[model samples]
Target chain A: MQRPLDVLGSSTDKRIIIKTKSGDSIFGILKAFDSHINIWLDEASIDGEKEVKLGKVLIRGDSIVYISPEK
Target chain B: MQRPLDVLGSSTDKRIIIKTKSGDSIFGILKAFDSHINIWLDEASIDGEKEVKLGKVLIRGDSIVYISPEK
Candidate 1:
């Protein structure tokens, strides 16, 4: 019974990666999502910053080139 | 003190709404966001479903037409 929201909600504590249309990749833990499709990504490199907000993004599931979850 | 991710994360418990590029609107509570920009929106009017997941969506901040939080 895996729901789509589950994917977004449970992504916390997991290493998630997102590839944008520009071919740039953003890697971080699942933070939060709102109606605006705004994303809160805690990037990997910044030390102890907790989370960095990526403002709003245009993410069509189709445009998502890649997604890798750390095991 | 308001970070972008904060917007996504705190949207929960609030009556949040999202406007899509197609000129359609989706209303719900903020659930989660991952690197892919995928959104977990708890749409309105779904009766006791708690939350529903909208697969990955293309949401450019600019494309987001409007957002109204319940007062």
Candidate 2:
């Protein structure tokens, strides 16, 4: 069975869309993640009520809802 | 430092609202959880597009966005 981390691991270095609890979506390239699911992303940008360029960011795990790999 | 799990540990046996990736908020009494954040809840109910009673449920962690203790 693929574990949650395993799924995320597969998406590393790939473009993924992360839906957050604050109702914001982050588009970026997955870089790294820890056991807590805290993620490091590059070329990130907020895509929601307020749009902004976020070159790189480490999103707290709890703030994230789901991570979907871009096709 | 309080980790994500630490926050959840404090909410054990308490009423909590879990926001999920599916855009549903689950109201329940926290029971147990694992490292993966997979949670077991009692008296679980969905509060979103559709409402339903779920006596007991184990929610996969990745599907969860945030867990808030009911005030």
Candidate 3:
């Protein structure tokens, strides 16, 4: 079985949703991440629909709830 | 052998640490929970030291990172 990080890494360039404790999620192309799980997203949206104008965004690892790949 | 919820239920009255998405944790006596995994803790503390006067507290399931039994 692939490790969790490996699975997360596989989602790179794929549209994924990064859920946070706030009950909200960021949907974007997974760009980069580190051991801490902090992420960088390109052309991200809030909840996969509401587009955020920001070209790229950085999310703190500690604030992460979970990361799910969009089908 | 016990399931996750069962194991959590067994931790009732025992001091446990409920880690959250923020990388912070709630330490307290596990008192109650539901199928959703939302939890209630008694005499809870933040990070197991700084006491929060609140006697009981509720934690949203989605915000949970993990729970650990404290020795």
Candidate 4:
């Protein structure tokens, strides 16, 4: 059976859109991740409202709703 | 590390709400699941609309946006 990691390739350069369990929508570039699904994103944004100046942040998998490749 | 199945527990009678990646919101009774996170739900509904007579269905994990205990 294919794993979630397999569903998503290991490239840290793909752009993705994420919706958090708390209902915050985000957009960013995938940076890194672990087995627990914890992820780091560069140039992230929330609800398309403002740019997250840090350009990098880690997201806990438990808070993840869905991750989609940016089209 | 806590797994998704562990996070949800083994109770099949609990009520749950799920938001799919396609954006349909469903309310139902959690029935069963596997490692892939495929889920069975009884009495499921879409967007809080009409009741689903089949009362049972499976949801693939990849399409899941979020799952929450009925609140």
Cα lDDT for residue A5, candidate 1:
49
B1-71 per-residue lDDT for model 2 (tens digits): 22335556677898877767776878899999887778899999998978999989999987875555665
Clashes of each: 6, 0, 0, 0
iRMSD for every model: 8.6, 9.1, 12.9, 9.6
* TM-score of candidate 1's A chain against the true A chain: 0.51
Query: Candidate 3: how large is its RMSD?
Result: 12.0
In candidate 3 the C-alpha lDDT for residue B59 amounts to 56
Candidate 4 chain B lowest-lDDT run of ten: B48-57
lDDT of 4 by residue, A29-57 (tens): 98877655677899887774554554788
The RMSD (Cα, Å) of candidate 1 is 13.8
**Candidate 1: segments with Cα more than 4 A from true spot:** A35-37, A45-66, B1-60, B63-71
Estimated TM-score for each candidate: 0.36, 0.56, 0.49, 0.50
lDDT of 1 by residue, B14-35 (tens): 5555544444556666566554
Candidates in descending lDDT order: 2, 3, 4, 1
Angstrom error at residue B27, model 3: 25
Estimate, for each residue in B1-71, the C-alpha lDDT of model 4 and write its tens digit: 77667745644679888888756686778766567675666666556244433344445576687788876
lDDT of 4 at A23: 57
DockQ of each: 0.07, 0.05, 0.06, 0.07
RMSD per model, one decimal: 13.8, 9.4, 12.0, 9.8
lDDT of 1 by residue, A1-71 (tens): 88554565666556677764444465666455444334444433211224333333223344345555666
**Which runs of model 4 end up more than 4 angstroms from their true locations?**
A48-54, B1-71
lDDT score for residue B33 of model 4: 57
**Comparison by lDDT, 2 against 4, better one:** 2
